[model samples]
Target: MTHIAVLGSTNMDLVAFVEKAPQRGETVTGREFRTIPGGKGANQAVAAARAGATVSMIGAVGNDSFGARLRSTLEHSGVETDHLRTTEGSSGTAHIVVDDHGGNAIVVIPGANGTVDHLVPGDEGLIATADALLLQLEIPLAAVLAGAQAARAHGVRTILTPAPAQPLLPELLAATDLLLPNEHEAAALTGRTDPRSAALALLERVPQVVVTLGAEGSLYATRDAEPVTVPAPRVTALDTTGAGDTFAGTLAVAITEGRPMPEALAWAAAAASLSVQRAGASESMPYRPEIEARYTS
Candidate 1:
């Protein structure tokens, strides 16, 4: 199995299902409420492990019930959490509101995740052993940069998902082997609304880019390679909370296993399609056999 390393955040997702999202300064009634173990970091780790990669997570949680649940959830999903730290405070939390149409809006409060500003000793060694390193912006930008630098030095392929989109530094972009951003994120990163143009704008900073267009598909681009578009499998989406993370994790695993880009994107799309059919974050990801069966069928 491909050894994948993820350096990111872990949060407890407090989700409320409602008929529709609340408008500005409006209070809306919700039908149900639940807490799920999540965080872009944890979600991707679980997704990759379920997709058959040997995944290790390097992140911090808080000394709280949510933290315990998050760690246990990752363990149950077959992720190695030896480097998961527990701080003496509240765990990170994401307040999410899901509409009847499966659309979601989220607000994140970084608690322990904010504390992960630097890599502790031995963290670099862990990155060195991985076939690929996955990172997200949910954690401190300093830590993300450190992880990317370590991966680059160790000759490990580095995939960066710039979520909760923010302005990225040139140094961070230079260290990224692949940049995966959703359409909105791509627009924020490159200041271009057109997916193809946005991707082209990003290539000037990173060598490779994948712009995810939810429901429609995804577009892939590399410096010397022709751009390719992969259509997503049609499915009735119940919840799309972790679909992008699922796609990124499966794509990273497939690439680490030496699958070609097109095939890997296809596999990722299939896995994401399955994830959207369910609810929650990590809980929605499908296993390797399930993904394979979906693809073969």
Candidate 2:
């Protein structure tokens, strides 16, 4: 199996289902509330593991109940958490509001996630061994850069998902092997609304880029190859919280397994389509067999 190392955040997602998001200072009745083990790091690790990759995580949780649950959840999903640290402060939490249409607005309190600014001892060795290193921006930028640099040094492919989009340094973009950004994130990164133009703009920074266009599918660009579009599998979405993470994780595994880019992208899109039909973050990712079945069905 291909090995994947993920360096990012771990948060417990506190979700509330409402008919519509509340306006400023206007209280609206919600239908339900639930807590799910999430965080972009944990979600991608779980998704890759379920998609048949040997996965490991490098991140920080808190010395709180949410941290404990999050750790257990990752362990249960078959992610190696030996590098998962526990800080003295509160665990990270993502306060999310999901409306009836499956759209969501989220506010994240960094908490312990803010403390992961440096890599722990032995983390460099792990990065060297992995076939691919997955990363997100939920954690501190310094740590993400450290991991990306280490992966680049070892000739490991570094896949970066710039989520919760922020202005990134050119050095970070240069170290990335594959830059995965959703439509909104792509726009945020390039200040371009068209996905293709955004992807082209990003290619100036990284050799490869994939712009995910929610339901329309994904667009891919490489230095020499012409850009191509891969249409998403149509599915009635129940929730879209982890769909991008699912796509990223699945893409990593498929690429590591040596599948062609177009085939790998189709496989990833199928997995994400399945994920959106379900509800939670990590809980929504489908297993390899499920994805294979769906793709062939």
Candidate 3:
């Protein structure tokens, strides 16, 4: 089994679907609502687990109802939660608004997730046992750095997703094996609006970088070779949320299984294409069999 450890946040997603998102001081009626299990960390864990990896989640949830459901959801998706801690108080929540065009805006209220500012007992051991350590910026920077540092020390591949883009520390980039960022995040990080320029700039710090371009697929850059662009399979998207997480998770699984980077990117893109055709983050992830079929076909 491909063992992947995900160290990050866990939150309950409170989603509202509207024809269009509301503007400042404007209230718009939503067409639908849902409470979904998600956090960048939890979602990636689910995506990896469903994509045939033995995935473990190292994060914190609260002792509230949402927390319980979140843990169960991870378990249901075949993610190992032995390192998932339960803290006192409300769980983290992501207030999301999805527009008809499949775009979304979100506000995350960190509750128990905020408590994970440092690694707890068993965190390093769990991370050490994995073939890859997956990370995201949804949690505290210290904990994310700790996980990356541990992964680097153990020779485990570290894939860092720079979501909710923020300025990154040099130490964090130095430890990251692969940096995954969406187009917007890439632009924000490098102050360059173009993906090619942004990715090449990131490669100066990290060994490899993958800039996700939604329908345009993804771009892969590495120090050893020229950048490669892989096109995503075309599909009507119902919800674009979690597509990057899905891609990152499936790509990690594929890489752990010894697939070449190009093929892995194709597989991840297929998985992401499948995800956008559905709604919700973790709920939309396709299993390994489905991803394989999409990749081959």
TM of each candidate vs. truth = 0.99, 0.99, 0.99
In Å, residue 267's CA in model 1 sits off its true spot by 0.2
User: Comparing 1 and 2 by lDDT, which wins?
Assistant: 1
- Candidate 2 C-alpha lDDT tens digits along 123-193: 99999999999999999899999999999999999999999899998889889999999989999999999
lDDT of each: 0.95, 0.94, 0.94
Encode model 1's per-residue lDDT on 1-297: one tens digit a residue: 899999999999999999999999999999999999999999999999999999999999999999999999999999999999999999999999999899999999999999999999889999999999999999999999999999999999999999989999888999999999999999998889999999998999999999999998899999998889999889999999999999999999999999999899989999999999998999999999999998777
Candidate 3: stretches off by over 4 Å? none
Residue-pair clash count for candidate 3: 0
Error of 3 at 240 (Å): 0.5
User: After superposition, which runs of candidate 1 have C-alpha atoms over 4 Å from their true positions?
Assistant: none
lDDT of 3 at 197: 97
Q: Which prediction has the highest lDDT against the true structure?
A: 1
Give the range where candidate 3 is weakest over 10 consecutive residues by summed lDDT. 117-126
- Indicate the TM-score of model 1: 0.99
Q: What is the alpha-carbon lDDT of model 2 when measured against the actual structure?
A: 0.94
